[model samples]
Target: MTFQSVFRWFGRRGQSTVHQVDQDGQKEFTFRAVALGLIIGCLLCFTNLYFGLQTGWISMMSLQSALIGYLMSKFLPTPITAQENIVLQTTAVATGTMPLAAGFVGILPALGLLEEDRDGTPPVHLSWIASVGWSCAVAFFGVFLSPPIRKQVIIEEQLAFPSGTATAQLISVLHELPPPDTTLRQRRGYTELDTEETLNDELSPVEPTELERLHEAAKPEPEGWSSLTWSFLASGIMTLGAYFFPVIFSVPLFGNYLAKQWLWTFTPSLSYIGQGIIMGFPTTLSMNLGMLVGWGILSPISKHAGWAPGPVGDMTSGARGWILWTSLAIMCSDSLVSLGPVISEIVYKKLLRRSISLEDEEDKEDKEVEPDDRLVPMKWVIWGLSGSVVFGTILVWMVFGNEGIKPWATLVGFVMGGLLSVLGVRALGETDLNPVSGLGKISQLLFAWIQPGNVVANIIAGGVAEAGAQQAGDLMQDLKTGHLIRASPRAQFYGQLIGSFLSIIVTTTAYTLYNRAYQIPGPSFPAPTAYVWLGLARLLRDGDLPEKSNVFMLAFGLFFGLVSAIKTYASQRQRWYAKWIPSGVAFAIGFLNTPSFSIARLIGGVVEYIYYRQVGKENGGIRLIIIASGFVLGEGVVSVISLILRTFGVGVASCWGCAHGMCGGCPS
Candidate 1:
C-alpha cells in the first residue's frame, strides 16, 4: 500500500476490522510471543524512562514493536501469527508507557534539591518501595479503566484512534500471505534480476549504458532502513564526540553555550531537533512566540519596572517567574475550553430524551450479538478496577501518610483520577492528543485549594491524577489497536498487566539508580518539567500569589488562551481563518524550559518545512521522518550510556555540565 493510503486509513471511521476474518485463529498469548514481548517491553521501558526524564517527551513503541516483531518472526520455526504480533505490540507499548508515571521523577527529585535543612522540614527522599507502589497504583488504575473506555469511545462513538488504526494496518500487512511465485521483494515492488550480470551492470560505477541508468533511476531510492541506519550512526557519533571532545578542545558552535552579554543561548541538541521535526512547524512556531513574549518582552518590561529579581539573562533568577504564572493561567484556561465539545456530546447523549436513530439502533443491536472472539468481558474490567482501587488506596495511605496526606484525600485523588481518565480517553480518541499536563494542573489546583501550604500533598495528589489519566488514555488506544486486528482482548489485557508490572519494577530501579548518580534540577540534569512543577508547588506552599503585573499578564494570557481554543474549535469545522491559531500548550512549554531548547526545536521545524517545500511530502518527507526518528533514538541511547558511566565513576569529569562551565573545577 502507498503511504497516502495508509495515512487515509488512519482517519477513516467504520468497522474496526478491515479484514473479513482472522488470518491466524486464536494463536495469541503463546510462550514465544509473551517472552519476546516481555523482552522488547522491558528494553523500551528503560529507554523511555531515560529519555523522558532527559527531555519531556516519551517515544511511542507501537511502530517499533510491530516492526521488530515482524522481523523476529521470520526466524521462528513456527509462523508468527498476526494475533501474536498484536499481543506483542500491546505488551511493549504498555510497558513503555508505564515509566511515564515517573513523569513526577523529575519533579520529586528536584523538590529534594530545592529543600533546605534550615526550614525544619525533612528533605524529600521517596523510598524505592514508595516509588514503585505509587507508579504501579496510578498505572494499573489506568489499565483497569481502559476496557470501558474502549467500548464507549472505540465501539459506540467510533472515534478515530489514529495510532491504533495505523498499527492494526501494519500487522495486517505483515501477516498477509503473498501471491504464489511472488518473492517478498517482488511483493514490496522490487524486481529480482535473473543473473549477476544484470544486477552488476545496473549498479556499475563505470560509465553505464543509457538503459542501465534509466533502470537504476526507475528503482526506488534506498530509504527506510538504509536512511535510518546512516542517520542514527551520524547523530550518535556527533553527539558522543561533542560530549567528550569539547573538554579536550572547544568548538564554539558544537556544544551548548551561552552569551549572557547578548542575552543569547545556543544548545545544539540532536534530540531536541528531532523532536521539533516530529512536532512540526506550528508547534515549534508557537513555542518561539512564547519565548519572544516571555524573555524578549516580559523580562525587559519587568526589569524596567523593578519587578525582576535579577539580570534578565539569568533564567534561574526570578525575571521569568511572571512568565510561568501567566503561562500556567493560559494553559489551564485553554485545557478547560478544549473539553467543551466533548462534554457537550456526553451530556447530550446521556441526558437528552431524544430517541436513537433507526440506523444507529440497528447498529447497536448488531453489535450486541456480533460473533467476536476478541471481546474482553465487562465483568473482568469491573473486577480489575475494584482490585486496583482497593490496592491503590492501601498503598497510597501506606506510602504518603507520613507526609501528612490523609487517607481520605488519597481516595479523593483516586476518584478524581478516574473521572479525569474518562476525559483524557475521550480527548485522545477524537484528537490523538491527551491533555495530561492540563489534567495534572486541575488536580494540583483542586488539592492546593483543599490543603493550602502542603507541597507534598499537592504534588502526590496531582501526580496520581495525571499518571492515571495518561495511562488510561494510552491503554484505551492500545485496545483500539487490538479491536481492529481481532486480537483477544482478554489476552491483550493480560499482556498489559504483565508488562505494567515489569515496567514498575524496571523504571523504579532505573529512577533510583539515575537519581543517585546525578542531581536533578541541577546543572547536569536541568530537568525542565520538574522546574515548572517545583515552581508551582513552592508558590502554593509559601502562600505567594502572582504580583500585580503578573496578575495582569495572567488575565491577558487567559484571554489569549480562550481565543486560541475558540479558533482551534472553529478550525475543526473547516474554517480557513481559524486554522492559523497556534497551540496554547506549545507556547506554555516554551516558558517551562530555557529559551535555548525551544530555539533548537524551532531550527528542526524550519529544516522540516524547507524539506517539504523543496522535495514535496511523498518522497523525501517520509525519509526525513525515519532519519529524524533514528537521530532521536541514537542520541537517547548515547545519553543513557553516558549516564550509566557516570554512575560507575568512569570519566566522571566529563559530565553534561562540563561543556557549559557549570561543573566547577573539573579538569580542563
Candidate 2:
C-alpha cells in the first residue's frame, strides 16, 4: 500500500485485529522498544545535564539525542518501526529538563551557589527543608496545570507536539515486532517505495514487546479526569492551610497552588536554577528581552499609531507591559503561522485523501470498522477547567492569603494563569503552554498597581510565575505526544503529575546535599543570566532605560525570536534537525561562550551529518552515529551525577567520583 494509505490506517482507532492500529504494521508495543527508549532516555537525560552544566542550554539534549536515536535505529536486529521510533525519540527529548522553577532553586543550592537562608549562609549551604518545600510546591502546581494546559493546546488546537512527535517515533521503532525487510535500501528521489516482504506469519502479543504495552497501559485513562480532581482537591487544602504554615515552608505550597492562578504571575523571582546551568546568557537574555522589547517599545509604538499589539492589553505598563505585549505578539505569530499546514494535512488525509478507492484487501479492514470520525470528546475540557479552579484556589490561599497576597489577587492570578496557557499555546510556540511567566509579570504589574511594596503579592506572584513558565514548554510537548499517539490527554496529565510528585522527593534530597557540601568556586559558579535579564527588564520598567545600551538588547531580542521561529519550523519539517543540532545552538551561540566549545559542537554536528548521509552504506553509517552519540550523552550525564554527588561530600571512590577527579577543574 502507498504511504497515504498507511497513515489512513493510523488515524482510525480500531480497524485492524489489534485494539489500536499500529501507525505502521511494523509499529506495536514491545520490551525491546521500551528498553531502547529507557536506555536512550537515560543517556539523553544524563548528557543533557552534563552539557547543561557545561554549556547551559536545555535543547542541547534534543540535538544530540536525535542524531544518536537515528543512528541506533539503523542497527536494530529487526527493521526499525517508525511509530515506536518517534515515541522513543520524543521521550528522550522531553526527558531533558529546561529552566523549570524547582530545577533552578534546587540545582543552584546543590552547586553551592545561591545563599539559601537570605542571611549569611554560604551559597552552598541551602536548607534541605527549603528544598523539600520548593520541590513539593513545584510538583503540586506543575502536575495540576498540565492537564488544563494539555486540553487548551493539544486538544483545542490539534497542534503537533514537537517533543512528543520525536518521542513517538522513538517508541514506535522499539515496539514494532514483526520486522520489515532490513536488507533493502531506498532508491533515490522515489516518492514511494515497495513495502518490505510481509511478515512470515501474523504477529501475536509477545513478551519482547511488553514494555510498549505497559507504557501504553500506564497512560492516564478518562482523559486526566481524576488528576484534575486531585489538583482541585490539593489546591483547596493548600490554600486554606497556607495561613498556618511557616513562610519558608508555605512558599512552595502557595506558589505551586497559584501556578494556575494568573499566567503572568506564575514565574518566580528565584527561577534561575535550571536555566542558569543549561543556557548561556545571550539566549536566555534574548528570550526574556524579547518580552521586554515587545512590551516596552513595540507595543507602545503600535499603540501610538492607533493599533494594539494583539489582543492582550495596553503596553505602557513599563517593561512589564512590554513583556506582556511581546509575549502576545510571539504567541500570535506562532499560532497563526503554523495552523494552516497542520490543518490542511489533517483534513486531507483523515477526511478526503483516505476515501480514495482501495483494493479489496485493504477494504476488508474498513468493512469491519466503525465509521465515527469524531475526535476526542469535550468532557476533557470540563475536567480541565474544574481542576484549574480548584488548584488555583489552593495556590492563592497558600501564597497570597498566608504569605502576604490578598485573596482577591489569588483568585485573579488563577484565572489569569489558565488564560495564559490558552493564549500561550494559541499564540506562542510554547508546546507546553504554561502561564507562570505571564502570571509573574502580571503580579509585578499588580505590584506597580498596588503601591509597589506589597512584598507578599510580589513573592507569591513570583513563585507561581516561575512554576508556570518552568512547566509551560514541557506541558505543551506532553500534550502533543498524547494527541498524535492516541494517548488519553487525562492519562498524560496524570502521568506528569505522578512524575512531578516523585521528582519532588528525588530532587529535594539531591538538592539538599548539593547545597551543603559540593560548592565549586570561580568559573564553575553558575551564572544567573536569565535573572540578570529579568532584572534589567524590571529596571527599564522602573522608568530607567539604559539609553544607548538598550538598543543592543532589542537587537538581540529580535535575533533570538527570528531564530526561534526558524528552529520551530525546522523541527516540524525535518526530524533530523531535532535529533542532532537541537534548538539550543541558536540560543547558546548568542553568548560569549569559549570558541573551543563552539568548535566542539560544530565537529559533533559534522560527524552527525556524515553518518546520516551514509545510512545506506555497507558499514551502516547511521549506526555509528547512534552509538557514538549514546556514548557522548552517557558520558555527559554520568559526569554531572558524579560532580553533584561530590558536591555533597560523598566518597570519591565510586565510579562517578573517579570521573570527576579526572575531569574536575575550576568552573568556567
Candidate 3:
C-alpha cells in the first residue's frame, strides 16, 4: 500500500479488519503474542520505576518493545503477526507504565517521605498486597474508559498522539511487503559488480555472496547501518558520558552561584529533548515560560523575601516547597477552568439534543457502520467503572477509616477522577502530555476542603485522580496505536485489561523489591514527583503555611490561572492568538521541576523546528519522528541500564563537579 493509504487507514474504523487484510491471514490476540508481551512487560516494568523516581517522568518505550519483540519472535515456532506484535507492544507499554499510574514512585512513596519528614508521626505503610489492590482498583477503570475515548480522539478528531502514531507506522513498516525485485536501494547506488569491503569496512564487514549483496541492496536501508539506529546509539553514548562526567552538560543558565541556588541549568537530558521533539514547539515553549516564571522569577524572590526558609530545593521548608503550592494552584485553576468549554458543549448537546453531524455523509456512514464488535461496549464501561469504584472505596474505608476518608468521599474522588480523565485524555491527545500530576493536585485541593486537615485523606484522594488520569491517558494512547495499525480495538482492550492485572502484581513486586533493596524517597531516589504531591498535601494542612506567604502565592497563582485559562478559551473562540497562550499544565510542570528539564525540552523543540524547516514537512517529518523516538528510547534504556549497574555497585560515581551542588562533594 502507498504511504498515504497507510495513514488513511487511521480513519478507517469501518473496515475494522485491517489486521486480516494487512497481515497475510495472520490472526490477532494470539496466545504466544500475549505471553511474549507479558514476559517483556514484566522485564520492562523496572525501567519506568527508575525513570519516575529520578526524573519524575515516564517515557513509554513502545518502539523499543516492538523492535525487541520482533527480534525475540524469530526464536518462536512462527513469527508473530503484526497484530500480535501490536499486542506485545500494548502489553509492555501497559505493564511498564503501571508504576506511573499506580503511583509507586509518586503518591505511595510520598507517604513514606512525609512520615519521615514529620517528627514522632507514626509511619503509615500499606502492605504490598493492599498496595496492589488499591493501585489496580484505581487504574483498571481507565482500560474500560479507553473505547469511547478512542472513538472520539483517535477516530473523530484525529489528534496526533505522537508516540502512538509513530508506533503504528513502525509496525506497518516492519510488516510491509518485501521489497520489489531490484529494490529502491539497489537503484540508489549499489551494483552487482561493486564490492566495497575495502573502502568502507563498516558497510560490508565481511565479504558477502552475490545473493546476500542483492538482498542487502534490496532493502531500503541496511539494518546494520540505519541512521535511526546510529542516532539511538549516539544518544545513549551521550547519556552514559553525562552519567560519568555529570556536570559537563548541566550548563548554568545564569552563573554557577545562581545555578547552584536556583537550578537554572541545562540538564544533561537528551531524553527530554526527544520529549520536546515529540511534544512539538508550542507546549515546550509554554514549559519554558513556566520555568522562567517559577524558577527564574519566583524562586529567588521567595528565598530573598523569606517566604521559604529552609535549604534550597527542600520540598518541606524550602523555596521548592513554597513554589509547589502556587504551581498546584495554577494547574488546578487552569485545568478546571479550561474544562468550561468542554462541559458547556456537553451541556448544550444534552439540553438542546443537538447532534451536529460528523464532517460529512461519509463520516456519518462510517459511524453508522462502525461495528459494535469493534467498539468497547458501554456495558464494559459501566461494569469497569462501577467495579473499580466499589473495590477502591472498600479498600479506602478499610485502610483509611481513621484517616477521615469516608466511603462517600472516596466515591467523590472517583467521580472527580472520571471528570479529570476527560481533561487528561484531551491533553494526551493534543500534546502527548498527560496532566495526571495536575489532576492529582486538583483532587488534593478539592479534598483539602472536603476533609480539612487530613493529610492522608488528601494523598489518597489525589491518587484517585492520578491513577485514573494516568490509565486513561495510557490506554487511549495505546488504543491510538492499535487504531492506526488496524489491530482490533477489542483485542487491544483485552490486552490492556490483562496488562492492568499483571501490572498490579508485576510492577508492585518490582517496586517492593527495589524499595527493600534501596530505601526510596532518600537522597538517591528523591521521588521528586511524590515530593511535590506531599508538599501540596502538607501545605494544604499545615498551620505553619499561614505564617509564610505561600498561601498568598497560591492565591495569586489561582487568579493568574483563571485569567490565563479564560484568555485561552476566549482567544480560541474569538480567533485570537490561541497558539501563543502558555499551557497551564506545562507551566505547572515547570514550577514542579527545575529549569534544567524545561530548558532541555526547549532545546529539543528548537531542534525539531530546525528539522521541520530544513527538511520538507512530509517524508522528512515522519523520518525525524521515527529517529527522534529512537533518541528517546536510547537514553531511557540507557538510564535503566545505568540504574541496574548502580544496583550492582559498578556505576556508583556521581556528581563529577561541585559547581551546582547536586552532589554535596565532587566525586571526581
Q: Rank the candidates by TM-score, best first.
A: 1, 3, 2
Off by over 4 Å in 1: 1-26, 31-40, 68-81, 105-107, 110-120, 170-223, 246-258, 261-263, 311-317, 366-373, 538-543, 546-549, 575-580, 612-622, 652-668
RMSD of 2: 17.2
Whole-model Cα lDDT of every candidate shown, in order = 0.63, 0.38, 0.66
The residue ranges of model 3 lying beyond 4 angstroms of the native Cα positions read 1-26, 31-47, 59-82, 115-121, 125-130, 148-229, 235-256, 354-386, 395-408, 422-435, 480-486, 513-519, 522-524, 542-577, 648-656, 664-668
Report the lDDT tens digits of candidate 1 across residue range 1-668: 77434323422311232322243544567655666677667767766766566546575657557656554454454546777787778888888777666464454664464556432356667779888877766768888788777777766656655556555644554565221111112111112212111101111111122323322322233435566667767767766665564332222343343434223455666766876786666668878887788777776677667776665434344665656666766677667776666676677666753565666555654332224455567787788888887787788778767564677777788889999888878766544567787788888888888977777777778877887888888777677777766667777888888888888887788778777876654444555566567656766667564455557556756786677567545544435444246677777777656566678788888887787678644334445666676676667667667667677776643544444453312452
Report the backbone clash tally of model 2: 94
Candidate 1 structure lDDT:
0.63
TM-scores for all candidates: the values are: 0.81, 0.50, 0.76
For candidate 3, write residues 257-283 as lDDT tens digits. 877776666775766777778666766
* Tens digit of per-residue lDDT, candidate 2, span 1-668: 76434333333321232222242344433333333444555544444433444334444243234334444444444433444443444444434452244544323423343233431233333365555554454444444555555544444333433334444433333343232211212211111111110000001112224435433432332322233234334433432222122121112222332211211211111112222212222233433443334433554464454443343232233222333323333332333333333344445545764454555234334221111221223464466445655555564465224534565565555555554444444432322223333344554555556535343344444555445545655556545544544544433343344445544554445434433443322223232223322332344245454223345345544554565456445544443333222222233222322221333334343444444355421233223323334334434434444555556554422232111111123110
Error of 1 at 205 (Å): 39
Which candidate number has the best lDDT? 3
